[model samples]
Target chain A: MNLLFILNKPPYSSDIGKESLDMALAHATFDDTVSLLFTGQGVWQLKTDQFAKLAGLKEFTRLYTGLDLYDIDQLFVSENALDTEQLTRDQLMVEASVLNDEAISRLINQQDRVFCL
Target chain B: MTTRFSILVTGSPFTSQAHHSAQCFVDALYSKGHQVTSVFLYGDGSYVANQLMHPANDESHPHQHWRELAQKHGFKLQACVSAAAKRGILSREDSELSGKSSFNVTSPYEIAGLGAWVEAVANSDKSLHFS
Candidate 1:
């Protein structure tokens, strides 16, 4: 089944943001086709130079690099969110397809299950 | 068509509206003669079955409400074991293994693994996430 996870929280501030990714990873490890869509403040989760240790949080952004091993390579980011945050693709740790509002709508429409993490 | 829904809740009881919305949705499904395979709690939602959460006498008790609903509908309420462990929601076995003196998991609420979650989803027609 195709599952889409919509992440909306910034990294480090909320523990759910990390546990939500862990859940997604668990699903992906089960061989399910999973996609991750980062929107709003969630886009910060993909930043390459993240040092969550300073905030007393585990550094997990680099885990995205290993997602492909679990066959979970469908990573997407909201173009509007990135622009709103003045972020560029160069700041991201892993490659992601930047999606517009319409594309995101279509992506969500095609999913069997969509969860807002 | 009787839809079998499997619910995933990721919000806390008192601080978030996710639980309230999920309960009402489950009620609507029950009213329509639909079935629920299971309600799986993850993230902060794992606190739903803390067993130690005793709200004010006049306030609605979320844990009791869910337990009663599960009993009435004959659906299992499962929380991810990993999630529960992270939040200090330990079972009797886990509490003992961890050298803790207290345990919180009660009847009708099972602290299980992701395999249980997958089975719950597989048994259902659709999975709805309330966060």
Candidate 2:
């Protein structure tokens, strides 16, 4: 199944985003085709050089670095989200392709299931 | 014709309407002769599984709605064990493992891994998320 996970919350300060990533990994481990879409402030999760330790929390964003290990290779980030944060693709921690609204709609249309977290 | 459904709850039990509203929706589905294969409580939504909740007699809280509905409909009510743990909702095994004095996960509501939700998703005709 083509399962897609849409994460709209930013990293740190909450466990919602972390659970979404873990659930995505679990789906992949079950042999389902899983993908991730980072939208809204969630795009901040892909920014490089996070200092979660400063917030007294573990750097859970590091999990994205190993998403590929679980066969979850498809990752996308919203263009407006990055622009709103004044971030560029080069500033992202991983190699997620920036997606505009039209592209995002297409991506959603192709998925058998899309989970918005 | 849709028959089997898989529900995901992602909102806080008391603070959010996910549980209460979802209970109504589940009943509506059953009224239409549909089957709920499973209801997976996740994120802050796991707070509903904390059966230790005690509301005053004059009012009702969101706990046990799923437990009762699942019993009537013969469906499974499960929660992500890790998420439930983070919110202080523990299963018997977890309570024992962590040496906690008590466990609050109510009967008919099981704490499970996310793989169980995945299985529900794969087996159901459709999946719905309440937040």
Candidate 3:
């Protein structure tokens, strides 16, 4: 299935986003195609310097690098959302392409199934 | 067309992408001729149906937008009753019977269970989760 996941929460503060990311990883590991779109506070999860002990949450930032191992490489962040949050790609731990709201909207409309976390 | 849905709105009216996304989905669904049968407002998303909300001069309240949309389009706005009651939002009768101070939920919207959300998924052609 062509699955799309829109993550809204920061990686460090909430278990929901983490669980959903784990689910995405699991699905991709099982040979499913998964695309990830980060918007709002969710863009914060991809930032650099995110360690488990400092954030007091399980560290999954490393998974961003390992996603290629599972073939779930379509990672994108909304440019407007990133700018609104004052985040830059240089601050992200993983390589992510920036998307405008129009692109994000189109992606959402095209997905076979979308899971937002 | 087939109805596709299952939504999650965690942000409150003050700061959240949930309301915007939900509205966009509604417009998109309608334009595409799909249907939205049930919307699940969990965590802070439950505030969409709060009847007592009156925004002051400062905030661009998303609650008002949701309220207007729900009223205008006949969308089913559901707040998790457990969360609603815990947060001191209930129907008038619920407030009187339970002895609560605030009544947060009323008509146009209803308090429901997670099973209802599951039922929506099962019955729909597809499920779209809005986080």
Candidate number of the best TM-score: 2
> Which pairs clash in the backbone of model 3?
B90-B104
- Give model 3's TM-score versus the native structure: 0.52
DockQ of each candidate, alpha-carbon based = 0.60, 0.82, 0.14
lDDT of 1 by residue, B5-119 (tens): 9999988888999999998899889989999998999988999889999989999888988998999888889999989998899888888999998999988999888877777
The candidates' interface RMSDs, in order, read: 1.5, 0.7, 6.2
**Superior by lDDT: candidate 1 or candidate 2:** 2
Give me candidate 2's TM-score against the actual structure. Answer: 0.97
- lDDT at position A1, candidate 3: 61
* TM-score for each predicted model, relative to the true structure: 0.95, 0.97, 0.52
Q: Which lDDT value does model 1 have at A4?
A: 92
- Two-way DockQ contest, 1 vs 2, winner: 2
In order, what lDDT does every prediction score? 0.88, 0.89, 0.72
- Return the number of clashes found in candidate 2: 0
Q: Best to worst by lDDT, what's the order?
A: 2, 1, 3
Task: For candidate 2, write residues A8-94 as lDDT tens digits.
Answer: 998886887888898999999999999999999898888898999987998889989988789989999999988898989999989
- lDDT by residue for model 3 (A1-117), tens: 677888888776655676567656755655557899999999888888876876555687677878888898899999998899999899888888899989888988877778875
Q: What fraction of the reference structure's interface contacts does model 3 contain?
A: 0.26
